[model samples]
Target: MNILAIDTANNFLSLALHKDQSTHIICEDIGNKQSEFILPKINQLLTENDTKLQDLTSISYNAGPGGFTGLRIGLSVAMSLAYSLKIPLYPVNMFAMYHNALNTETNSIIALDAKLGQIYLAGFDNNGDYLIEPQLINPEQLSSVLSKHNLINDDDTIITGNGWTAYTEIFNQDISSQNIQYIESNYPSAATMINLVLSGKSQPCAAHEAELLYLRNKVALNLEEQKQSKQ
Candidate 1:
């Protein structure tokens, strides 16, 4: 399988090219400049590998619960490239990738700092399937939601993604578990996205139908709009 993947959901901006069973990455750029840097990196990778756009069997991208600007950049490039290349665009959930990266004996909770004291969170079972729809909530609400979803008392649980950094203390004190592993090296990356894409498990999205999964719409709204909607 030949695959190309891009991720700009967090501080890490990455691109990966996979041919056969080997992977080549073109990264080390700042995440904030993804829009400006991604295309050049893509061209560079293709050139280095002696490949072309039409050579890609599939293209995948991180569909966010991430930086507003970075998400737009990553998605726009992905949708445009997929459309132009006449290939499918796969939207890989950040949480799913996080779960797949873990070696957990049970469910894995993927969380990202949603800012404003809230987190964008999702849950995945041992087999890397969605256990709950993604949502925006604080630590208490997240715990409550997990309980409501019947995910409590997970004896062998592992929590990952950027959310761990924000809610580690709360999770350590509150969530009951015999084993909890927080792996920092498993940060979100396009390379991980490509792994799922090649495995044929990523959700296929069309150019027009593709949408960024911002957990809270209000965060994207202006202050006046937010106040008006509240009223």
Candidate 2:
């Protein structure tokens, strides 16, 4: 099966083509100008691979809990591609993509800077199974939320994503555990997107069902709701 994967849900704009048992990620571009270059980059990838849009068996993308505009752009592209090509679209989370990016298993948390001093967060066990449902929360509330839900692990916890860079001090102070491993190099990639495309894990959905996975219903309203819920 041939699958095309995309991830523009963050600063990174990447595209991958998965064929045979090996993954061929033609390009993984990182920049702030996703809106300007995403489709052109995709076209370049297909042209380089000597493939056509209709040749893909599936389309996979990072559906987000990240940037509002980036998420909308990526999901729109994925849905449009799937609709035009008559292929299934899998809206995988950036955390799931991060999980598959891992070369080895370990208790890990994936966070994406959700702006306004909060992040989109999720966890995975050593087996890469989801330990906590994905949500948007502030760095100040992260530790307490984990404790309230009994999701804290004494084992070394690996943390990755743009959030780590943005809220380093807050996370460090809140986590408290001495065994935290922070990875600063990697970002979500179309290569990780291919993991789902190749696994055949996504179900075909109607065009209407294909939508952005905004962890928070209304990004602008979340801060008010969080404050009200706390009060």
**For each candidate, what TM-score against the reference?**
0.86, 0.84
Clashing pairs in 1: none
Judge candidate 2 against the unseen true structure and give its global Cα lDDT, from 0 to 1: 0.75
Regions more than 4 Å wrong, model 2: 26-32, 149-153, 200-204, 222-231
Candidate 2 per-residue lDDT, tens place, 133-154, comes to 7888888887876776565664
How many clashing residue pairs, candidate 1? 0
* Window of ten residues with lowest summed lDDT in model 1: 176-185
Task: Please give the lDDT score at residue 179 for candidate 1.
Answer: 47
Once fitted onto the true fold, the runs of candidate 1 whose alpha carbons sit more than 4 angstroms away are: 176-185, 220-231
lDDT value for model 1: 0.76
- Clash total of candidate 2: 0
What lDDT does candidate 2 reach at residue 164? 78
Query: What's the lDDT for all of these models?
Result: 0.76, 0.75
